[model samples]
Target chain A: MLHRIEPRSGVAFTLKRGQRLKVSDPEGEQVADLLAFNADDVDEVISSGRTLDYASRIFLTTGDPLYSNRSNVMLRLEEDRVGRHDFLLTPCSADTFRIIYGDEHPHRGCFGNLAAALAPFGIGPDRIPIAFNVFMNVTVDGATGELKVEPPRSRAGDYTVFAAEMDLIIGLTACSALQSNNYAFKPIHYEILD
Target chain B: MLHRIEPRSGVAFTLKRGQRLKVSDPEGEQVADLLAFNADDVDEVISSGRTLDYASRIFLTTGDPLYSNRSNVMLRLEEDRVGRHDFLLTPCSADTFRIIYGDEHPHRGCFGNLAAALAPFGIGPDRIPIAFNVFMNVTVDGATGELKVEPPRSRAGDYTVFAAEMDLIIGLTACSALQSNNYAFKPIHYEILD
Candidate 1:
């Protein structure tokens, strides 16, 4: 199934075991905040710490295992064209906007979009996990050790593919940081293949 | 109980919820590889992805939530002095060494120490996840998004405290990158508070 996630919006679906979820930057330089949970429990979603720990690498490359906190393998990086998908940084949230930009800006971030999409599943702000910022460019300076978030390195039509190790509920957002220059600020194209 | 982790060695312990685990760099510039698994499952372990996601930030700070992949809250940052702990990059591994430094240069990485420590728990290399590189310095250049793993900015006696959310098995290692100047190349001081 293929879907189009409009800007500032999100979509949610289940990715069964062995199926691959492909999120593409069809026009390039866009970012998608990806969040996932176990289809059955929903509580046991992907843990960035565990995935990084188990993979033993910071950057997600092909063959990297995305492990859940329960030590359960959830997904595997089967393919990646850009090889720079971000698993370290966090997605922008409404609380973040409220805190950083003030309360005037409320419904303009992933926090709201994810909450709305997962609302049917009974997930709220407390349960909404930070997402994997796909197609986002980030760099850590070697000398100063400063982290800089930038635009995506992906060219048009660039995409990353992951195989589900178990059934999953994958959620995505067309990044809500619309006014920021750090991300692509474009729409996202997503698909799931059995 | 307080324990001193020797240089190039690692230790494993169980932490119950509300218990705080403190790791300190007594002499400064040392890195501790923190790995945790659910005490009951072991398969579901600490996730860098989840911790960063739930906390909604890239860096760990006091009061940040450390979440498991099950979207379960596993730990919390109760206290922090040098707030530069890295949950983004992964620890140095042996396979990574062999690929970069050749197989002849054996026993010079965190992989062996972590593997040895967790072997008793039936965790093999295939199961070892990338560890949380605590007290380690990682800077991503904002302009270039270039990630630089650097030396610690932490002073001597600096420590970070984390409270357990669930019963967990924590593994700590004194980094084995003997030739690198990027990390604290020393022993780690750890203690558990009730």
Candidate 2:
């Protein structure tokens, strides 16, 4: 069954070892932020540092392993149609809107959405780390090392698949930031497969 | 008086608004990781996301502002003798050693050191975020967005000065990772100025 995540909202669930997850951009240009944590200990959560250090690249996609802070592989990217993703950029949050956009009223954004979604599993805001931003187009300037968020290349129905390596808690969000989605918000879809 | 952080160790202290912190590489080719938190509330910590988003560039130096997670300015870089630094990499940890280098006897690294030093202030490892790396040289491949850690350009006595924008709790470390300091561990020197 396809599970739908409404625009700017999030969901949390558990995936047993060997189960597969398919996250799809049902509406073109939307991005999803994905986070994984060990079911047994939240402290041993997914780590961008370890994964990037081992991979030696910022563009992670098919065949790449998402690593835990404790040096264990949590998931492997099994398929990816939209290859451009962001591991360096953090999830957009209320502070992001207030600081960068100078918005008078800031939405809680993905960080808040993830915090609320993961609260039932005892994950606090502090425990949230940098996410694997699926289908988010972030371009880094080669000469200056500057970062820019661009519109995702995904068309409708584009998706990525991940195979879980362990029992894992997952937090997935349809990114709430304006710039990340090219100024338009849209829903995301996901499905679990054994 | 100048304070010394011995190799592979760290220290935490408070800095009042308008006070200045000068972190110097007394020995050439050494690196230090620096973190700041709002003194009144530890939850309002320094944020790489807010800083980078507002700056639009990754290479932060003189005249740049380090922002808090709450979208407030925490520190301002007043002077920078070594222009190259990193805000993208997480502080090296035991997991960094075990995961990247496959070290069987891994050192606790800067993450553990910072957690230990800040424990008295009630800050835990989960509260630690990506640091402002002083004198650490990291280069990204322009074409592929791949990242590479390089030897710092700082010579002996090179330093950077930051003015606190608010009352803050600060964590500073003599980075423990070999690759970060060109394979040689050296002490870091710092002084608090009025």
- Span of 10 residues, lowest total lDDT, candidate 1 chain A: A139-148
In candidate 2, stretches whose alpha carbon ends up further than 4 angstroms from where it belongs are none
Model 2: lDDT of residue B15: 98
lDDT of 1 by residue, B42-113 (tens): 767666644554454567678877765454667788888888867664456654455445667666467678
Question: Per-residue lDDT tens digits of candidate 2, residues B51-133?
Answer: 88778788888999998766689999999999999888788998888877889999999999999999999988877888999
Q: What is the Cα-based TM-score of model 2?
A: 0.93
Error of 2 at A192 (Å): 1.3
For model 1 the local lDDT of residue B85 reads: 69
lDDT of 2 by residue, A78-169 (tens): 99999888887668898778777888899999999999999999988877777999999888886686888899999999999999999999
**Whole-model Cα lDDT of every candidate shown, in order:** 0.71, 0.90
Q: Candidate 1 regions off by >4 Å?
A: A1-194, B99-103, B178-184
